[model samples]
Target: MASSFAYDILSNKIETRSAKAGVIGLGYVGLPLAIAIARSGFAVTGFDIDPKKIVSLDAQHSYIDAVANDDLATEMDGGRFSATTDFAGLAACDVIVICVPTPLTKHRDPDLSFVEATSRSIAEHLRAGQLVVLESTTYPGTTDDVVKVILEKTGLKSGTDFFVGFSPEREDPGNQHYHTATIPKVVAGDGPQALALMKGFYGAVVKTVVPVSSNATAEAVKLTENIFRSVNIALVNELKTVYAAMGVDVWEVIEAAKTKPFGYMPFYPGPGLGGHCIPIDPFYLTWKSREYELPTRFIELAGEINSAMPRYVVGKLAEALDMRSGKALSRSRVLVLGLAYKKNVADIRESPSLRLMEIIEERGGKADYHDPHVGEIPSTREYQHLKGRKSVDLTQELLDACDAVLVATDHDNLDYALIANSARLIVDTRNVFARLRLSADHIVKA
Candidate 1:
């Protein structure tokens, strides 16, 4: 009866759009989520440690391509969305969503510092009759075992004094087809009341809410999706190298295989795995499965191949430079195109492009890069020791000046025609010039 009454009150607040939603960590995931929640008629407050992000959101500017300037202005101007650097400001919020980063440690282990810090902060300000949801991706049992333990230390009982749940963030930055509002939200909670409240909150913002059995179930769902991609991508990358030796184009082969339309899904080959998800998420499970004495061989294998792609690409660069007599990679001036892992985004966390640049520098080769979306490289978690560099302009003179060009990321907006027409040596890792007939004297597919 206590749990039932709690759900009733939470549902009433959500149905009336009177619930105050507070999102911790105003990043690529948090910002869009806050926007969607605000648009759904709830007053949303965004909290972040970075004052720069707070200022940007307050000024009605969006740093993310998925979120537009006009949308930020609408939320801020309409008095539905506001950002803060203070955690104490979340007091009046009925629902608090944690959307902080869950990056891996230097040793490639699960680093839950962000999640732990967020929980501690939330526990500091946790109020009665409020719901707490963790949207940050992490290993299973983190929401129940870790977060629940931390919050209960405040003498507040979960699902009774307060509600707690896990709803994995399904944010795909730069995806034209799906946004936070359109994607189905998967929700689970510690108990019936908490689950119902999670459903009510997310259902108000997103198109649908998929309720699972438990918080751990919801957590595992996210890891499973990324693990599938990571493993498939590794298989494709391994085949890419094998196919190249046999004079077969993996891209062409994929096109024919995908035509079957059933039982086969196509994953592309790239310089390496990049972005926030594939390179990082699967390892979370790998680290956790060890507590059970079980090894995640497929996860480790996929990561091994994906991480080695930069070296593979660098090897190809050396071979490409060898085409010119006396031209060693150690003395080659190479310019890399695109620094973001995927195309048309500014996120460079674990980006293979940077890894490629580092490899070139290590091999005594001069390396520079250009990405229109990313203007200046920031200090990344994985590549902290990496020197920061600004994005170079894709000029004809710049293209012609380099000894060889490596296409690490194939952004659609970039002029491949100009790069192909001007560069003396071209080592295409992403197959950017596949559709276009290139005129470069020496073109090699890595």
Candidate 2:
């Protein structure tokens, strides 16, 4: 079959909402995307390696906060959505989307293992007239050089026998203002035909589709967005430390500075960078830059400053414990607040809270945590010893029992007033108590 004929068939299927869509790795990005695609009138089959997720979807239960049970049930009932663990189902779908993780290795280099594995799996069932889009965040040339090469190994040429594109996911978990469909998608493809198919398909689901020149540009778009954030956040984290030494509140400065409205944008400081993107994405570019022998000094500096935050916050905790409570950190009982990277979200991927706990324990301090959103610490690669620890109840007795409270993540649902009245000493990394107008003599901002 000619490439134009295959493109026409897939393009028609996308236009008439007759396309059978398959989404792989149905976790944070995939599940919501699959739901949105299905809601746009396509029959979407979600794929994942986890049987538990398959079972959960089968029972109309939603593991992600953005996806509600009622909405999931409605989709399932309407026969628009289903999930499975079978890669062979890919052969039956006209549009296959990959939404897998692209994590960093221990040395802070790009780990394309997940993306490579997913591409190989798709290649196993790849056929003509199908459009495969990669929504994973990666370095430039990944879609064209890495994923395209893997798929073409099956003797089918992209933009001919099949179409290939890149549309990096801009998933902001727990953001009230934006969801999968509301966020504008940046799409690019191997060729003009593939680009048109990408725009046509994504245009049906999202509110807007931003068509870029090539797959590399789209990949660069995701990296730039994250790198900009990482850099600005590093600046604030540095300023936070500097202002703390001068006894000036960094939060107040940010509040006043953001009021300018024209020139300034606010990026708040936390214990450290967290979630999947800001902490890891900039490093993808930094690692790639090394291949060309170009320097990424600014990016590397930001990463270093952000990476050292847990230790910095822990140092303040120790100082607060010693000065305010007249106790050594080794003998103190510390309550680390919020396990999630950000507030009100249960995602702990690359969260600095894990690092804070590890540092506290390494210093011989007893570390316990309390998060309203996270019930128990899940298994993570870096923090194996901290795994399985349960979130402690936020009772007055529990607060009083602790020597100090370290506010790593300021979840909205937590009782700030109770913490103010009960805890003997508080090291406020998030400045939550001040934001809520609850102040006490013992509260110290880190």
- Write model 1 residue lDDT over 36-93, tens digit each, in one string: 9999999999999999998888788898887899998998899999999999977789
Give the poorly placed runs of model 1, Cα more than 4 Å off: 1-5, 439-441
The number of the candidate with the highest lDDT is 2
- Candidate 2 per-residue C-alpha lDDT over 286-338 given as tens digits, one digit per residue, 9 for 90 to 100: 98898999999999999999999999999999988888878999998999999
* TM-score of model 2 vs. true structure: 0.99
Query: TM-scores across all candidates?
Result: 0.97, 0.99
Can you give the lDDT of residue 230 in candidate 2?
96
lDDT to native, each model: 0.89, 0.94
